[model samples]
Target: MQYAQKPELYATGTIQLWEDPHIAKGMLEAHLAPDNDAASRNHQFIDRSVKWLSTLSPVEAAPKVIDFGCGPGMYTSRLAKLGYEVTGVDISENSINYAKEDAVSNNLHINYRNESYLELKDEGLYDWAILIYCDYSVLSPEQRQTLLENIKRALKPGGKLIFDVFTPYQYEPLKESHSWYAENASGFYKDGPHLCLFSHFLYEDDVYLDQYVIIDEMDQVDVIRVWDRSFTVARLQQEIESAGLKLSAYYSNVAGDLYNEASKSLCFVVEKW
Candidate 1:
């Protein structure tokens, strides 16, 4: 008797898929779904960011703010409503289009651009810059430095830069095994109820890799892999300073508490001198 060889399994996906226009649209819509309670979360985050900004010395009347990687325009809409002239930029054209449509539906005037953050020009025009959702960690050290330099050139003297980063504590526990599964009737209507398996690995000091396998009832499986990095407070501070920005405050939470080693989030408030 002859036995067939078992098939080899390899993680297969493209950065291009994540950057796809339609896929980006679908993902954003899913997050912004009316019944998802995401709207409430958006409002809460915006309220907290606004309160923090209010504590700062007011910028010249009607400060201009830019939201880098403004997915679906959630925070962009919030900031605009708070009276800041807001512009949202993303690398996905589809996401930008969706954001523009969303702004129209909400009757909010926002500038939505389909451009990479690195390509944004410095006209010395902005008063504030924000990179939320731990997005800044996506860049390499050199890219981060370049981004800071660009932000500084884009801001007026004394303008501020605020962003957040994940800490090492979050990664330590994530190195363990984790898995979850869910099933629902919506399967026929959309990407059906599925079972998800997750595996995590600490690739380096600040880098982690997560593999996600989604299996439908029919045994079809789709695997997605994501890689992310965490930044230490000291390393982050050094980058900010090297970029010519002054670190004025650091908080471990959205509510503005002093940062501790174990804090999962490191929110930064830096001013351009």
Candidate 2:
């Protein structure tokens, strides 16, 4: 096995982290972990975020909202409860199923679809489009462009896209590193004994990658690569305007706090031009 080898940029993992049954279960668990920020933000932060989002369009406005990567309806259900017309899209069928079931149990009216947000084709359909939890930072440059275009098409004139991305400060402390471990009990990567090799990489353009190479008892190997591209205000503005959208406002977080250089992440409100 090629241990600690860096693959090409944006190379896909052998197993789809979001779609694979075993990994998806772990991802869902991470998302549901009350205090964990592994997948979704902590519940308290999500509560505050939903409350802040509600204020964007008064409940009386009854605005339409499309949430990309809306895992297990964490934010969608809350927004729906606040009377927004909500539709959630996610690539993980496992997550979508859970979200759909939860919506039913709560008697919340939400449209949940198991599909990549990049496949969104709606044209001028929503008053607000949200991609939270800094999911925007993981996409490749080309993918980011496609996503921006898709979001632009999905929004109505004057509609706003609210998203967040990590700032350079977020990864300031992570240095290039490599490690490995053996697990006999079932864990996040698989259901049986495995040797997991890990590599933390820092690349140009404020990008970082966390790579995992997993080898099972049968010698079957798989790889998972997670990429994060941090951004500055100037870089973000350039990208937003390049997509034919206008950067209306930016903050340190989705909670609408003003941004400062020391902030580790940034939230942006981009309007369809």
Candidate 3:
């Protein structure tokens, strides 16, 4: 007897990282990993980011800031401690709860919202808006444009929007492949006896897809898809300008380091006025 072949198609997103209980639990675990050396995932990077933001001309005076995709209050709490009025927004309820708890424990006054950044409004209120962790790169081109417009609308005149995006150097060398793993009551997929298949695919438009297919003990199958869009300086400059924002500076990794030709990711600073 032969088992039926597994279906191969566009990965259906069911095991959501930001929503499902198991996935959310896994995400929170990743966010709180007790290591600072991991850039973008720990406190050392947060400190570095806050220090770099402080060096920016607009942030030198501690202007009100909006931290979009502000997971676990990493950057938001620090910015608030640095004396900038802060509002943090994220989609994960768990993360937002944790962020609020952190804010209260630190005696930091910060407005934390559990919502989508695409729904952001409150025009002309923020002096600075930031979307870190390469969150902007995961959005579609249209969504990117909308996000920029929303950020622009939310900014005060001359206010700036800062974000980061991975360039070709990060994606060009990534080869598409598939793999399998066993999850026995641990890992991103909990419960017992899960056969997980992982896939990576690249598109012509610099979009990359990372998908997971998991079949659990009771024969329940789940899918999750993550998209990453890569960019070049010229292409990014055009996109920023098209969104009605003025590109002011581009740096390597948000540390205010110069963006050289070989940079894997570049951080952008754009002004609304």
Scored by TM-score, the top model is 2
**lDDT (Cα, tens digit) per residue for candidate 1, span 202-236:** 55557765666667789776655555678888888
Worst ten in a row by lDDT for model 1:
1-10
TM-score of 2: 0.98
Order by lDDT, highest first: 2, 3, 1
Candidate 2 whole-model C-alpha lDDT, 0 to 1: 0.91
User: What is the alpha-carbon lDDT for the whole of candidate 1?
Assistant: 0.70
State model 3's lDDT.
Answer: 0.80
What clash pairs does model 3 have?
none
Per-residue lDDT tens digits for candidate 3, residues 1-273, read 011223333334776667777778767777777574322456677678789887783455547899999878888887887788899999899999999998888899999999988888878888888888789987777788788888889889999888898998987678878788887775676556798888787777787888777788888878777778888988999999988889998898876778898998889998987
In model 1, pairs of residues that clash are 187-192
Top-down TM-score ranking: 2, 3, 1
lDDT of 1 at 117: 86
Model 3 TM-score, 2 decimals: 0.91
